[model samples]
Target: MLDFAIFAVTFVIILVGAVLYLYPCSRRASGIPGPNPADETDGNLQDIVNKGSLHEFLVGLHQEFGPVASFWFGGRPVVSLGSVETLRQHINPNRTTDSFETMLKSLLGYQSGMGGGAIETMMRKRMYESAIDTSLKKNFPLILKLVEEVVAKWESFPEGQHTPLCAHMLGLAMKTVTQLVLGLRFHDDAKVLGFRKNHDAIWSEIGKGFLDGSLEKSSSRKSQYETALSDMEAQLLSVVQEMRTQQESGTFIDSLLQSNLTERQIMEDSMVFTLAGCVITANLCIWAVHFLSTSELVQEKLYQELDQVLGSDPITLEKIPQLRYCQQVLSETVRTAKLTPLAARLQEVEGKVDQHVIPKETLVIYAMGVILQDANTWKAPYRFDPDRFEEEAAQKSFSLLGFSGKQACPELRFAYTVASILLAALVPRLRLRRLEGQVMEVKSALVATPKDDAWVRVVRRS
Candidate 1:
């Protein structure tokens, strides 16, 4: 009888401990409104997967919980700010660290040179910004030449034939970014294509793998991702070596080589910029042209503006800002397409948004998609209208969202220039038309892309 009682007591104790381990007290202690963890281990992760993406999940979350909401991402508590006002409270212009860089480093698993004193960080930032500025200034004519080649190819297409807009744009972007940022070695078609293949493999995995923990789960995927990453690193290494040997100067890589950054730092930053610059520039141009295809009036207005500004000359760096209407078209496309849906910042210290106090080290999500589409802020938020930005308030709202002025990331600023050049070149000579029965479904990842190939036919404008 004594042995039976002891065994029973031990069993009961173990059961109680297991229960507590699996399901601890709810971590929803911030007094902020959100759903509690669906599972103790993978909080809201399944929800994110089911909703198709983090951005889509945020849309539903903000709809239910208002502008500011909290959700558990695995074991971590993440607070999402979905309104322009909430974003304003969350953004600090003077902060030493860039949240985009932080998020990107975490995604790519690149850690070198991420930690430093404030002066070092600022110096690195300035170096990078200057490199991009210098690259653009020095290579503007080359960029224009690339744009003209693409336009000429499109012009060669027979009338009424549909073009694969996404594929063409991706190719153009890859060529433009690689040659300009890495070096002229990418001018070779085979080298450019090979780099792109590796890039696509690594990027595709990085987008989906980190979200669902699948990269760690699948042995095949893990092996392939590693192989692709190694190949990409090797490619970058070769470029760095060649540049060092040649004593190259005045280009993007040349600028980085001259800087005090370590070889690893140079590689990592180059990878970040190349991946970001290619994907963003491609998608922005694709979406801008796609949107224009669907709206004749908008396209005509843009053409009129381009005609009035440039007359018969190719676009130059000096004349870019003078095309105000063209800028508006690009701005509207970004807002309407929600190019980058989500961004995040780790709360370095405890922060406050409205009545809630965000705990230190919490992940704060800037739900940019939600903010861009908020009907309260944007009139006809779903419509593809460029004139909405004619108001000073709308432009101010955009600047606050980090899409304009100095708030724009270096990659985005570069993308804007590249895209503007493309639009300027193409719009004056060709009329973009959407193919019948084609619909663009958004696949929201690090960048928003069409789920299927977006096709359009172009008619020569007399």
Candidate 2:
């Protein structure tokens, strides 16, 4: 039996060695993996695909291999392009066949059957829009009005000292997006209690399934998400019914109704708007405050921009455009924080990438976080320097992160509007300071979250 075991081990070792030997090594590039760009895989590479956590592995592999490297993920061809220009061309393919939906379909397991959700379709279209839609446009004041309620709560909290101002970012984001879309504030001493309960029950555990293969693996998790989504749908639909009865003379809902959109489309689109807006805004606010507090000089500079542009007046969407430095600060905040919140895709027939001829069906992905931080493109790639974006060229360089230029999301034109108003509202009334003894970094997930709670204390300016 011992002799048989020894022979079995020897046979396995030899087979593995033979497989590795057959695999091509760096061919085209100087420091990359795979054979030359000429070498193409003749067969499906499932081993590379199913390895899972495929992103982390590919990042490490790319670091060794250099730009334009290829790897396998889920029996599909995956290529990593580190340069910004090349990346821009990769995602904006001239076809509707490739998009965030392909990725969502993968995540939601949206196969041919099961009947897809309207919310998903609405989310995709909104994401594709270059700027805020005509419907959401009317809700400009409502967005800030909702946030003012959240800011009021923070003001009510005890004066001075350390506070978990961190958690409030999410709640603020939730309230702003919720009210903007549904015209309802869902957080308060009473409602916050419920929001927290529902939030924890649903979202807290949603990320855990990301580890063990599919998000569908946990029945409890699947149910929690479904329940949360369904509850949201019900809440929005009820609001729609109420709005229909009142028939507001002028409002976001009124505009939504006037459009030839279906009832189901309204609910789905609003939810999509909520998801799209809430998550990014909250994190940006927290990160901006955290970074600003850490540098008094930078804070002072931002204050100068704020006070000089529209002194003692509430920030309006019209005024936000002229605040260039403040805009730069916000842009720098996004760049430095590297939220890389989501990945984008396009179905370009894959050309030859390293050892593999990217088959037409293979999905192509770009790591926004890593791509944004490329040392070749960014000086002091890891440093937090707002001035880098102060110049036109430097600022233009960041268009890959969706600020301006060809791939720019039109919503970004207004994100500045929202971010500017929020910052202006607080800068005059509060002083933000980062907490001590905490490691500040980013949490890697579907979106980048501040790794630590990112706590700060706010002192109301007298």
Candidate 3:
């Protein structure tokens, strides 16, 4: 009886020890400060959802835990850095790998060339940058023409007519991006509209499906998403086949064809640029106009700058730089809107930020939304003040966040030029006013957009 009692005691002790080891209640492996896992399996995922969005959750996390914080994403441990000083330490200027590319490719399930060696990656990066640069230079005239078309359409609207701002901006973005990146086939309105429809289907699914694993649960949604993706890919493939037989027009596709990239490579890169470019450009313009409509002083100041600088002369590539205040307004718009709210980097090797060591292969998030709104960094961080960007320090800080200057991604650079032209063309001839009693709620996703149709009324500036 004594032997049996001792054996039973040992068994219970072993079982409890194993259970504790497998399902840790307070696992802080990195010694970083953050909430413990809410469940053994889901980790802090429910916490993320309850907070509304990853950006919002990060804001709260950083607010509570300071600049460097940690959280469990599923079974994986993740670290978030929410300040300029921490970000400066983490971002390596000499690193060739594009963190955004990695995230997008994972979301897209595009595997080719992703695991390439450093030299190959650098080569592809160069090719892509070169192609975008050539396309922008050659297509500058087309960009101006497209902006003029949008301005003309708005101008023709009768006084006090309510304009569907999001729709118009999205359409313009679709047309501009497609024609420049794909080919002249996009000049056909039907083709552009069809492409836009497919794009919307795929993009909406990609945003939602990856977020909550809904794509895996709903077969019909999954089927529709797959179909849309396939259709878009087919359209791109057809364009590639046609471009192969045609003369080079210095378009983005043309530049890629001139290079030694495989057909699949071209298609993948094209899809990335087309999707990212259109969304970023459209949202940037939409928010800029929305903000300008609310502030008469900003609109008037921008118009005065345009009037003084161009004075009836159309804006050219050389003239873009002279519009410094216009750039400031756009910069401020990006900052206030928190346009691209989140960015992430995988720690390829062990890394340290402010005494916390992030283990190799850990997911590191740049909580840009929090940093953008950090009161310590900006004066009255919530205010939409463009003049804040006039300070050299502000510009430096913005650049460090990858919104401007050489640090900005290629898509952002393209958006800036496209937006600058559109604003220059429209702000001078039209006064944008918000429709009364309309509430615009921001929906934060891969890109931030108005939750409903953003409506505005336009008056011809005399």
Q: If scored against the real structure, what TM-score would every candidate get? A: 0.91, 0.76, 0.91
Give the per-residue Cα lDDT of candidate 2 at 92: 40
Per-residue C-alpha lDDT of model 3 across residues 1-462, encoded as one tens digit per residue: 011001111121122222223222333377789999898787787787777667777889998999999887666577889999999888433367666665565556677777788888888988987888889889998999889998999999999999998888887888988999886767898988788778767766654564556789999999988998899888888888888998888788889998888888898889888978887888888889999999999999999999999999899988999999999999998889888777766666677888988766566778888888899899999989999988998999999999998889898888889999999899989999988898777766446667776889999988
Scored by CA lDDT, what does every candidate get?
0.79, 0.55, 0.79
Query: Which residue pairs in candidate 1 collide?
Result: none
Which regions in candidate 2 have their CA more than 4 angstroms from the true location?
1-58, 89-91, 94-102, 105-137, 149-160, 185-200, 210-223, 248-254, 350-358, 410-415, 460-462
Candidate 2 achieves a global lDDT of 0.55
How many steric clashes between backbone atoms does each model show?
0, 9, 0
What is candidate 2's lDDT per residue for 51-108, written digit by digit as tens?
2233344455557767566553222234556556656455344333223333323333
> What's the lDDT for candidate 1?
0.79
In angstroms, the error of model 3 at 248 is: 0.7
The local lDDT score (0 to 100) that residue 194 gets in candidate 2 is 54
lDDT of 1 by residue, 43-131 (tens): 77678767866788889999999999998766667788999998878734336666666556655667676667778888888888888
* Model 3 poorest ten-residue lDDT run: 1-10
